[model samples]
Target: MLELASNLGQAPKAEDLSKSPLSIRGLTVSYGQKPAVFSVDMTVEAGKMTAIIGPNGAGKSTMLKAALGIVPPVSGQVQVFGRSLDEQRARIAYVPQRASVDWDFPTRVIDVVLMGLYRELGLMGRVRAKHRATAMDCLARVGMGDFADRQIGQLSGGQQQRVFLARSLAQGADLYLLDEPFAGVDAATEKAIISVLKSLREAGKTVVVVHHDLATVNDYFDNVFLINTRKVAEGPVAEAFTAETLQNAYGGRLATAQVDQLAKALA
Candidate 1:
């Protein structure tokens, strides 16, 4: 969430939206001399799911990475809950793309989910029975309880995603960020993930996703952050996910048939 604030902690004007879980201002990132994201700004609507949508290589993933400091930006500032991100790390949970993971790491599903509890477990604490119970509950919520004892590398892509989602749930963070979670999953996995995310929003937790599926934007997200190496549009889905804003981000890259589908999807 990148609003041009004259003062960081000053009282916001009445016109400003409610609390922002994530905000960024003039965020610019470069890989070598090539720019990835350029002067982007955003303010995530609290308690809602915001989707970062754009064409391929449009800096969608890079923007999230920069916000979380996974990749340093060329120049920018990121804040979470009106505070520095470093000050609010425990309040946020992130799920990266499955392709970026090492599937052969030989970790068990339950162990992976338990990693979310490291903060609660502290530096030298051992996992107690209560911790295992919490981890199992999280896996059950994602429909993977039966596989808790299974090896992570043996699971299918969709199953692995569900396990990771379970891990995120076990974190019990107030804000969640996911990068292309539905990219390679089956329809069932997509449905399961969206269902859980919507539940999180209903519980008043803020969620942001680097989403690639344009067809589901209107149905799944409350807000949209459209970008293409720059801020194309940002606001509620009804306002920012419009045909005009989408066309502005995608330009002539979308086929006519695809445009028709987007029309029906947003209608």
Candidate 2:
């Protein structure tokens, strides 16, 4: 019984780190002729929670999109589970920003979650009882099991985010890429979401969240990537989430200047 408990406490290993769960080398992304992210290199360890944070237009979202192959990168390489993304597509799950999705589509919460199984279902297939069971379990994980039958439109902002999170959970992938999971969410909801993310890490999933609130950076993340059109720093929160690093990443901007002045004044 003790051995079983010990094994349960250990995070499930994914691909080897010498191979890397997700690796980007000399990654450059451009929209048309304008470069958005340049010469970026980063690695996400398996069974860890990584937060990518930066101001608006900092190419954070662009980088994630590029990694997912949604947008073609001008030059670079992306590997998932030590294999090319195409080879490991089924092992990844993406949760886009709530603003990017149409919440008023008139779909039930359970139906949206079951959509995560579409890749496995193929075009000609319908959701089976097993799929429904998986979706229910996922909803329960996110504390939305009771709302499974509710219309997505009737839910609040945080509830909507939970629906998406449930969908990602249903995918049962090794890696999860989430974009701003806490935007506009109430304090209680934010805590709930963070708890779910921590649970994911405990369950041996690699969860990457694109975050905006800097105040909670240190409190919420195990690893952090500070990005602004380029890789500023990537490592544990204590090492990378520094004022100097943030200044460098957001420098040359008026807001950054104002912040610098405020810091100096306060000091």
Candidate 3:
């Protein structure tokens, strides 16, 4: 059996740092000369769900990528569960935007999910019956069990998302980072996905998502990290998801009515 946390060979932690699931300091990302996200510092709450919200091009996705070492940043340090991200790779799971995937690739749903267990399977590609059963169970958890043998390109957008979530589930990771999981899906799919995420939180896992819908922020998340090229305000929904902070991040783009609705959501 795999250990939940890999042996990083680091000395003991100083109490508070060990409790932080994800931490980024002085994170800076750039697209050519322009900075995408700059000087951002965020510490995610353990055993909770957090949303990274900002207006278009505010670096919500970029920040996440940088922290995960997916997209290289100008400068930064990211720690996962009180250790360097590289030192704790197996403890993390990531799901990129659905649009970023290449559905046309010739592969069945099960193969994609099997990628999650690469570390466990090792070089000889020995996938035992137990591995197949574990993959199916993960698919079942995300409502994709029956589609394991189906072609990847044949599934609808929502179904595609669920399969990917199943893939992430197979990782058995302690921290999950998602990039706009709800971007283009229908309502029912969104509901199903959030239920799975909420269950993870209840089971002592940490989740961070790049979220766009302001209306559902309060209903769906325990904490919010608002950014617009830099950190705006980050804390619980009641504290950070406010009219003033919304204005600061979105400028005049967010309507007065939406801002008022956000205020009422906290009431």
TM-score, prediction 2? 0.87
After superposing candidate 2, which stretches have Cα over 4 Å from the reference? 1-18, 252-267
In model 3, pairs of residues that clash are none
Give the TM-scores of the predictions, in the order they appear.
0.93, 0.87, 0.93
Model 2, C-alpha of 263: deviation from truth (Å): 9.0
C-alpha RMSD for every candidate: 2.5, 7.8, 3.9
Alpha-carbon lDDT, every model: 0.89, 0.83, 0.88
Supply the global lDDT for candidate 1.
Answer: 0.89
Per-residue alpha-carbon lDDT of candidate 3 for residues 3-71, written as tens digits (9 for 90 to 100): 222332144655455578888778899989999999999999999999999999899999999888888
Give the candidate number with the greatest lDDT: 1
What is candidate 3's TM-score against the reference?
Answer: 0.93
Clashes counted in candidate 2 amount to 0
